[model samples]
Target: MQAFSKVLRLVELLLIVFSVWSCTQERDADVGQADKRTVVSLHLGIKTQMSSGCSSCELVNKYQWNFLYRIFSGKEDIEFVVYCSDENKREVEQNLLYDVLILVDKSPETDELVVCHGRKTMFQKAGVLDMFSMRQITELLMDSALENEQPLRK
Candidate 1:
């Protein structure tokens, strides 16, 4: 289940929490190959969102899905993060998730990932029987990385 931590933002105590969250390590890539070089990202926490936004979620989802279409359809060799979400909050927090995503990124590691879809495609072809698309899976890890790498509050 989704667990929301109760937070009180007293100025001094607030500073302590901010410092702790920001300084924590990013998560490791738990769903992909071991030889493509590395960076870490951690599972930060849940985000609460309005089903509707000031910006349309449809337009935003299309913008993201288009990128994946290009990568997979055109067979472009690209590496990026995808921010996925699912109703299965418990499974996700427990690291047993392989769900659809909401965002895609091209940063920090576009330089390191040179093989495009090659390794990832091979894994699927071999029928390894886990989450499909290690490329996409690693992208999710990048999302987790993003939280730790950025400031938590407005």
Candidate 2:
């Protein structure tokens, strides 16, 4: 009975490994067949501030990635990459490569936006919205394409 149980465990492990490998193979194949488009990478970071004398503190930074993905997935001319990182002061200073570097900062009571240019890599405070909107993102992408002289498909 012991020997039989060992063999069954080994078979289960092998089946698990094979299943994972098969999924990876399918993913790689799908990636290969997908149409390639210009990638607009959004490097985002969060900043938080603590209050000294507060009864309660509430933060509202609930941004959904699926909505953003749905907006760009159907566009053949553009692709988006939203990269989020932990809040670190040094990250703000370090020169990072991205199509757009957005800094999402939250203070004791307000939010701020810092936007960067893709080509020049220069950052500026954008006082456009309380938070990033899809319209702003699309406009930025269009501006980026125009700066690079790339024509949009359809």
- Residue lDDT tens for model 2, 1-154: 9999688756645543443344234334445332233444343322335542431121222232334434444454454443343453234334332333333332212222222332222222222233445456556656655655656543
Over the stretch 1-154, how does candidate 1's per-residue lDDT look in tens digits? 1232223224424433342333222213433433332222112122326443533331222333333333332221223333323432333334322223332221111111111222222111111112344455446434433533532221
Q: How well does candidate 1 match the true structure, expressed as C-alpha RMSD?
A: 16.2
Question: Could you estimate the TM-score for every candidate?
Answer: 0.22, 0.29
Mark the regions of model 2 whose C-alpha exceeds 4 Å error after superposition. 1-37, 49-65, 86-133, 139-154
| Candidate 1 Cα lDDT to native | 0.29
Q: Evaluate model 1: give its TM-score.
A: 0.22
Local distance difference test, each candidate: 0.29, 0.39
Residue 85, candidate 2: alpha-carbon lDDT: 38
Number of the top lDDT candidate: 2
